[model samples]
Target chain A: MVERALLLCLLLIGFWGVVAKKNIIKKIFGLNILNAAAVMLFILEGNRIGSEAPILESGLAQVVDPIPQALMLTAIVIGVCVTALALALAVHLYQITGSFDIETIRERIQDET
Target chain B: MGKRKAWSPTLQACLAIGAMGVVLLPVFLSQTPWPTVARDYLMQYGQDESGARNLVSAIYLGYRAFDTLGETIVLLVAVIGTMGLLSRVESLVNTVGDDDNTIQTVSAFSLRGDKRSSHVLRTHLLEVVTGKIGPIVLLFGFYVMLYGHLSPGGGFQGGVIIASGIVFLALGNQQDNTSALSKSSILGGIESVSFLLFIIVAMSGIFFGKGFFGNPLADSAYPVGFIVLLNSIIGLKVGASIGFMCIAMMGGHD
Candidate 1:
């Protein structure tokens, strides 16, 4: 329960960073934090039913659910893809506006028109 | 007045996040039990069916292989998008010889040390250390990738490590960044070829009457051969694409 609360706090912290942070890079950082919180939550849930890792060794039962772990691997890869794309977008924005600040980029775009 | 204006947005953001948290509270606090039937079933037959000791590997590379293919496609799309976006953004990183006053920007792939003979910041130690360690890391990545069926690591994990190894190789070359692995063209080729091979292997199962992503070697003495092949292919594809992107980002042209 305490772990869940801590993960919730982490999720909120990531949300705050995404919503309140001005720098696009920091926003990406927050997005990763959010991704981490999610992956951790899934893993934690899977841990509830197992005393061993998902590897099948001799005389080992009660192994954690491998489904969540496999699913989370896909999620982690997708997260990486999203992050790389976001960072590239940020770079393009920086190249255009010459600033990482969201307000400044908005102002630059508005001025451009 | 200005201070209050700055503080108000923070407060608003907090309230918004708090609202989201409240809405998500039931989800986080839910006491429902996770289903164990799948785990139990997989534990009993996953090894025999997939020939993988690691059940997680068995799931991704065997039972849910179609999802792996989809994820790789997503990764490829991301790489393509990044390449298109970063082509124009290269000017941002290729800032060589604009300022001669304080610090000179050298490309990470630059082979000419004589061009940068002024006030070096002790880069020799870093170069020597990472240069010696890069190939070792690549070897370890391959080891992890190949042994994933029997171990904790898998294609994605090993691939990320391999990409890091490539980055280290790119960074370590003080005289010449001629490592074939660091070249974007080579990396791109490897990625493309591996993806093609992955599809070919997937379709090969169709000819064997096992359907897509089914193990064609199910009747062979070593059924695990298919999983190992898939793991290696995925690892190479991921490592190459990521290394390609990282090299491009590091301003390593050609």
Candidate 2:
């Protein structure tokens, strides 16, 4: 219950960052935090009553779900790729508009159009 | 402007937070963790079927090899997209002319700046430290990739580590004469070749009467060798692709 609450709090914080922040980079970071929270939630959900590391060693009765761990690995990689792509886009936008502020960029686009 | 002013930042934040809370409330309240059936199956037959001691490796390389392939393709697309974005700046700089002053100003504007002309920016300590530790880091990445089947670390982790070592080297030494374009192309070629080899291996499983990505060498003496091979291929592809992305994103301003 505590873990779930912590994860939800993290999600809320990330949501606030994304919604309240004006800087595009900060929004990207907020998105990353959300991704991390979701990954942790999945890993936490996979914990069993008597779980050990999912290695094939002798004398191990229970093992945590390897499926969630593997899936989370994929999620983490995808998050990284998405972050890189987003940063690239941000850099390109910054180059063209000379600002990181979303509102200013939008205003400039409107003026140009 | 009037419409935008109606919703202040604090109000927007509160609304978002409240909405998220409401959406997540039920999920958090009724969280009954269920037992996974696949866990039992994987733990029981993972070693014999996949020949990998590490259960995660068994699942990643054997049971869900297709997903790994898809992930590598996603990485490849990201590398390509980053290169596309950064190379435009490089071309813009080149077309602007041969004037050194203009080139310096343009590169500075483009975020790569002139590294060769600015000698004072070079720090001797960083150069020495990276030179000493870079090879060890690369070796460790190799160790992780090679021993992935038996250990916790795998291709993605090892590849990122190797890419970081390359980044450290790139940052520490500015006097290297190799053009960024050539280096990027070489890395791109390696990425493509490794991905192709991965696909070929997947196809070879079909040729051997096994299903696609099915373990053809499961009955062989060294059953785990195929997983090792797949891990190495993925590691090389990921490392090269990431290295290419970093160098490309740094732009060819050097």
RMSD to true structure for each model, in Å: 3.0, 4.1
Candidate 2 structure quality by residue, lDDT tens digits, B74-190:
998987787677665544443334555443322332233364434333457766786567678878988999998888888888887777676555555545544342366677888
Estimate every model's Cα lDDT from 0 to 1.
0.87, 0.78
Among these predictions, the greatest DockQ belongs to 1
Worst 10 residues of 2 chain A by lDDT: A42-51
Task: Supply DockQ values for each candidate.
Answer: 0.82, 0.60
What is the docking quality class of candidate 2? medium
Against the hidden true structure, what lDDT does model 1 obtain?
0.87
The clash numbers for all candidates, in the given order, read 0, 0
lDDT of 1 by residue, A37-61 (tens): 9999999999889979999988996
Cα deviation at B56, candidate 1, in Å, is 0.7
Model 1: colliding residue pairs = none
List pairs with backbone clashes in candidate 2: none
